[model samples]
Target: MVDNRYTILVSNEQFRFTRDQLESDPGNYFATYFFGEFAEASQGAKELVVEKDVHLFRLIQAHLRGYDIFPLPDAAIPPYMTKEVAIKNLHRDAQFYCLGKLEEKIKELELMSPNGRTGVRRDSPSAKRYKFGDETWSGLEWMFQDLNNDGYQLMLGKLKNLDMAIPSEQPLIPGFSLTFCWAKEHRYYVLLASDD
Candidate 1:
């Protein structure tokens, strides 16, 4: 007998949940899409693939398990994540999944801060918006000129060299690691390195 369970794959992670748990709320996107009689998932499909951040998918699962995603408690924040990063990731996932209510809730949370600021500001600049294109280089120029002109020129040269060898569709260079971090003197740094 086939078990009444379904596997949801997000990024490189797999999550299994009972049919009942996913169908508990009939109006929910997951429930409606997976359990409705005429739905594709209801035709004995055993697995669904979701191309989203695994961490955000875990939070979405928690929401399905009767946990509210908004108004996140301080205790729920992961050790390596700041609350702003957590909310931003959740918001992106919610938006991608067409979870309007969840997106609204996240937006609400984003607009308010514990200290009454407009929103949570990170000490480091967000590199999520960066892409592999001329526009990205332009944006980097604007950002880096304010930090270190020499470093910006070196970085641009490196990026141009990489661009020549790698296709635009391939954002990740084989051996290089890219990271954003805060630096001394109130500057933000984009660090890139290759194994060589």
Candidate 2:
């Protein structure tokens, strides 16, 4: 059984769709395109492309721009596959992509200003906005309390968002991974994993 001890604070289906598209298509494309372009080029050409590589950057920009009209080249293209290159590219993409979501999360956290207040009118637009309703807050509160007890600085960290904003295969922190998602339908959903 999957470990359910960790909670899902929020789940953004669009975010998930974006991640899936990246992993399923663009991610593979860039991995192959770059490696192939490198391998097929002469040593001098390889250095030139390395110094001025545009394919991977373009693909990343395409995804970042959130445009889907431009069809990704079919995978029928032979696998110019290089595991090391693919892995490295995947890591870079993962970090950059997660950081973008991290920014969004930061914005949400910023919305939660003066977090320690209680019954502070509860009329402000931000208070009207609760992440995943109360359940999400419960789980987050648990984690925050635990982390605080363990000496993690609460002042240094806020519930910007959850790991559910990122892909299941990618982890921002070591050991434990958790994702939080919030969408129009489901106010909040979370997925957590502990390689325990």
Candidate 3:
């Protein structure tokens, strides 16, 4: 059976389209994804906007704690948490829990974890070219710009394919990782690639 636990984490705002709408027009199945920060919105903390699979609502709630405008899936805590808190936590969890390794994908397109952080495989050469965030982006970029520009949300699959393969034994810097997401299969899937 589908895990009902996933349903509890999502807010009503996420349900942009009805089940019938998805059946008639799959492309219209889009929703506003709110990536919250750990502090006040005016501070460095800000929500990363993106279009993602509806299933991610549960995964997001799984990591959340305390009160929030959006209640946590398993949390009994009240809605005291701000968007900032949610954003910070999500960033932390996404870096760890989201994607598979780069070397694995090169071997086969199937999703698989690598030996190192995210998708960086151990013992791989340091010659691979990589980018910290969006390789196609530059300047003071907003975290959620892609979400607004593109009608669809970013999915984990895109991250898996973005070649975020970094060298092994290196710590993933805060605010940066060789990860990406893709919007497909009605969900998001992150992948490990390096920008080294």
Candidate 4:
């Protein structure tokens, strides 16, 4: 008999877990969708493909195995997994998966300022102008003549340092035509032209 275990392909990595382990919790989307009685049965070893970050998926898998998502005691996390990139990736994946509890935990981590405070600094002029609240920021709508490459880079750096989460959806900036450039190392920037 073909083993009933399933293989999940995430990004370039393949993860194997038994049908039982996957179905152990009814709350898991994979379990509910793949292992439910109305779901199609697999003839042999089943392969499911997921378009997600593999490293993040591993953390999600660990959560499925009854582990709490981050702020896990430092001892519980592998040294290589302690970086900000890993946490950001995991948070993005959790949001994609609609794992509400895990998403909340990751948001808490994201909101922590460098000094261990719960909020970001609101002192800078840019910070005062752009940052709306804990998460949202005002979209930029400066006239073309008002912003230059150096100024844009400085603004981006400020945002990065503040750990601001820029919204992926760019709403049309009134009276400004926007252009995006993907420079070396895949860095993205938006340039504006005055519609006036």
Candidate 5:
């Protein structure tokens, strides 16, 4: 991961980025200043100092590094911030960096925000027992087929974006496991798990 790193001082705090990482996006603000036909590029400066919020810059750098969503939003941002304030700060930095489409992606992530307003994630180590221990071999296609045969429905429309936004290979749905539970409303909650 270390490839001749460069230091960036943001709001009196130091952050580092490798050469390829600085130039990862050809059109991004920092990438242009470091590699484009600019005066800074001529000097080959090893460090950059910018006056910006450190927390916001962290989110921007994560975005530049191909990370779209934080697995847990609360832990990613400053602890003192409210969810709305954090989202606002993230949006501000995203626009300031001229991050194309990141604004929309951030909004998409905000929709799935698990901040106790609508839902939240609880880490139950015993929930590990639901780790697909007894299930026989079957792929997503076959699993969905079996669910349908059992009058269980796989809600594709709701899960599509959440799956892409989350880092896990297993999809994030109503419940967080690879087991199917019967709902009183005649609905099936099928949670998928992977050997992580």
Candidate 6:
């Protein structure tokens, strides 16, 4: 009997996907790569060698097998104790794989400040937690622009202890303190006074 299972060799390790399973997501690159008009198909190859991070590839495999959202790193993974790097990497991978749903889900995750909770955003409105990094500043730039147009709310509420005083650190965007700050984690100062 002919085995309908196909092999995906990642770093010399093996993973399997059935023809039926792959055909289901014909739009995905894996399916196209394995089954499209190519040398592998003509040669009747049953396995395709893949070159990618094994952990990430496993996540992609799980996604193809119907995993909606991959979990962020739970513990301190070097250079990424924060959830930022993990999600960003996954989002990059999702885009490469053309997985729209996974990419969108990653984007919908909360933009947590250093002093904020990193729950799924449905858990709590996190304004204070710990470890404000470049990620948080990047997030704040556009997320609370309406409320922190003058950097008042951002200073008083979110970054109170960080010492991000207005004007000195605030952008000269007139009415908007528009800037992507690189200062977080280390001590800094910031506060805002409203025009009202």
The candidate maximizing TM-score is: 5
Q: Which residues of candidate 5, in runs, are more than 4 Å off?
A: 1-3, 111-196
Model 1, 38-101: lDDT tens digits are 4675586777887866766777787666667666777666666888887877877666656666
User: What is the C-alpha lDDT profile of model 2 across 27-120, one tens digit per residue?
Assistant: 3432333233545322322111222123434444345445431223543122463533432453465455453442333333333333423343
Q: How much lDDT does candidate 2 score?
A: 0.33
Query: Which order, best to worst by lDDT?
Result: 5, 1, 4, 6, 2, 3
lDDT-best of 1 and 4: 1
Local distance difference test values of all predictions, in order: 0.53, 0.33, 0.30, 0.52, 0.54, 0.52
lDDT of 6 by residue, 15-57 (tens): 8988766665446666777787767777777888867666666
Deviation of model 6 at 110, angstroms: 6.0
Candidate 3: how many backbone clashes?
A: 32
TM-score rank order: 5, 6, 1, 4, 2, 3
Give the CA lDDT, 0 to 100, for residue 160 in model 1.
47
TM-score of each: 0.46, 0.22, 0.17, 0.43, 0.52, 0.48
CA lDDT for candidate 6: 0.52
> Highest lDDT, which number?
5
Q: What is the lDDT of residue 68 in candidate 3?
A: 31
How would you encode candidate 5's per-residue C-alpha lDDT over 1-196 as one tens digit per residue? 7357777889888888876777655566776666677788788866788998787788777766767665436767777787678778877877776676667676555543323222223353432212111112232321331122111122344443433221223334334355432222322334343222
